[model samples]
Target: MAASEKQVVVVGVDESDYGVHALEWTIDHLFAPSMPDYPFKLIVVHARPSAASTAGLVGPGAAEVFPIVDADLKRSAARLVQKAKDLCASKSVHDVTIEVVEGDARNVLCDAVQKHNASILVVGSHGYGAIKRAVLGSVSDYCAHHAHCTVMIVKKPKAKH
Candidate 1:
């Protein structure tokens, strides 16, 4: 890959408390120093299930409720993206884009990185250990293990004592 070509920097955009911080740190720590001849781009992905049609539903059916919930999730995703972008702009970062993906966050982010041939996958670590992660599951660990590209696991800034 040439230095002038732009590589995709995909990040999860959701209400997760650390998502915004991950976005900010990525722009500052990764892209700013490594921006090639081309400007960097960010894809903010929010995943959810696709809507199911309820036109044929009667008194109570999954159809009526499913679409509304999915719609709400997309809206939330949009908000996260906006907040991230706004933060970036406030800090003078550019070349950012937001997107919503309807699926599992881990699967969606991984797929996107592959599809975009991403150079690095930036994710936040909620500090789940191996045993706990095995049961509860951690997106950061999943991406680090499954992503075809390099993965950057970001932990929350250590709290002040």
Candidate 2:
């Protein structure tokens, strides 16, 4: 594929409302335009769980949480991507390419951008402070600075008072 015409989009997914917002942005701004005309390829990614999580599930009702019995992070990631695709398809946005990539959100996204020759990278911002985010550099911040293509960070809506 020529570097000139190469185009693709990557989204970071998690349980956060921010991720959902990013999904919506991708649908409306990117995917919606190509729907039913020619299928657009979208890469939906989810961060993997930490190694310590394997020690055992946390909180009450852990066993019944996922409720799938053998549900794993990889499986959950795949499911979330499919769920996004299904959402788009229901609205006639068919032919989305889904993949569940594991690892750090920023790295995974950057890697995907390079791998698929993506022209844009989208992520959701938690709107945390520098000190707070310093301990955890925001994925949006990271991709915006490092990605090969344009980066769009979806800011989470303020909560209702």
- Name the top TM-score candidate: 1
1-161: candidate 2 lDDT, tens digit per residue: 54444367777777677887887878887666545454346777776664334435677777665444335665766677777777677666665666665567788888888998887778898999989899967888888888899898888778899
RMSD of candidates 1 onward, in order: 4.2, 5.0
Q: In candidate 2, what residue range of length 10 has the lowest lDDT sum?
A: 48-57
The digit string of per-residue lDDT tens for model 1 on 56-151 reads 344567666777766776677677767887877776666676677777778999998987888788887777778998997988878888999888
For each candidate, the alpha-carbon lDDT, in order, equals: 0.73, 0.73
Model 1 TM-score? 0.79
TM-score of 2: 0.75
TM-score of each: 0.79, 0.75
